[model samples]
Target: MTDISEVFGFIKDFGFPVVLSWFLLVRMENKLAGLTEVIGELSCNIAAMRGEIPKR
Candidate 1:
């Protein structure tokens, strides 16, 4: 009960959707970062992946 109460208080002060959006954004950022890391590792594993990162 105390934990729930605390969580509710935090959510109320922060607002649910805002917090959700922030968390979602953070998750998306982390997922994108992970994907980038995997891609980088794959590039390293490839034979000629070391020429350049290439422009975005």
Candidate 2:
């Protein structure tokens, strides 16, 4: 059996918006770092390949 009081009780026990925002921020930072790593790897690969192959 659920009541309005119980709903509020659960919300009081668990802060919703604060937790949600923190979760999103953490994931966004991770994704941004991953993208940076990929870009750096690609840049290095291009430079390496360019050096190995002579210009035509």
Candidate 3:
């Protein structure tokens, strides 16, 4: 049917970018988590240096 073909065509046109964006977002989430952890560690270190908190 023409409607079925049209649906497939629409999916073909838009699906790749949607899938790719999802994949990239998953990868970026991991990197952002690592970055957040590093930032927290850095903050702790700075606090220790300032004598606001005891060093571990």
Candidate 4:
């Protein structure tokens, strides 16, 4: 009984932060992917504006 209680107590203490961290990491990964794509697009646009790239 004490072991079960201890397990629950530990979970209560640490589970929420672990879950929250995992969720935030997943969200950040997606956001970073999107940001990376935007940065690539921006770089191409700048190069095109400077005539470093041929017009499409």
Query: Once model 3 is optimally superposed onto the true structure by TM-score, how far is the C-alpha of residue 42 displaced, in angstroms?
Result: 0.3
**How far in Å is the alpha carbon of 27 misplaced in model 3?**
0.4
lDDT string, candidate 1, 1-56, tens digits: 47888988988988988989999999899899999999987876663555565433
Q: Candidate 1 vs candidate 2: which has greater lDDT?
A: 2
Q: What TM-score does candidate 1 get on C-alpha atoms? A: 0.46
lDDT score of model 1? 0.82
Task: Give the winner by lDDT: 2 or 4.
Answer: 4
lDDT of 3 by residue, 1-56 (tens): 57998999988999999999999999999999999999999999999999999999
Ranking by TM-score: 3, 4, 2, 1
Give the TM-score comparing model 4 with the true structure, all chains together.
Answer: 0.82
| Per-model C-alpha RMSD | 7.8, 5.0, 1.5, 1.9
Write model 2 residue lDDT over 1-56, tens digit each, in one string: 79999999888778787799899999999999999999987877887788964433
Candidate 4, run of 10 with poorest lDDT: 1-10
Clashes of each: 0, 0, 0, 0
Q: Tens-digit lDDT track for model 4 on 1-56?
A: 57898999999999999999999999999999999999999999999999999756
Backbone clashes in model 3, listed as residue pairs: none
Candidate 1 weakest ten by summed lDDT: 47-56
lDDT of 1 at 22: 96
Pitting candidate 1 against candidate 3, the one with the higher TM-score is 3
Q: Give candidate 1 regions above 4 Å deviation.
A: 1-14, 48-56
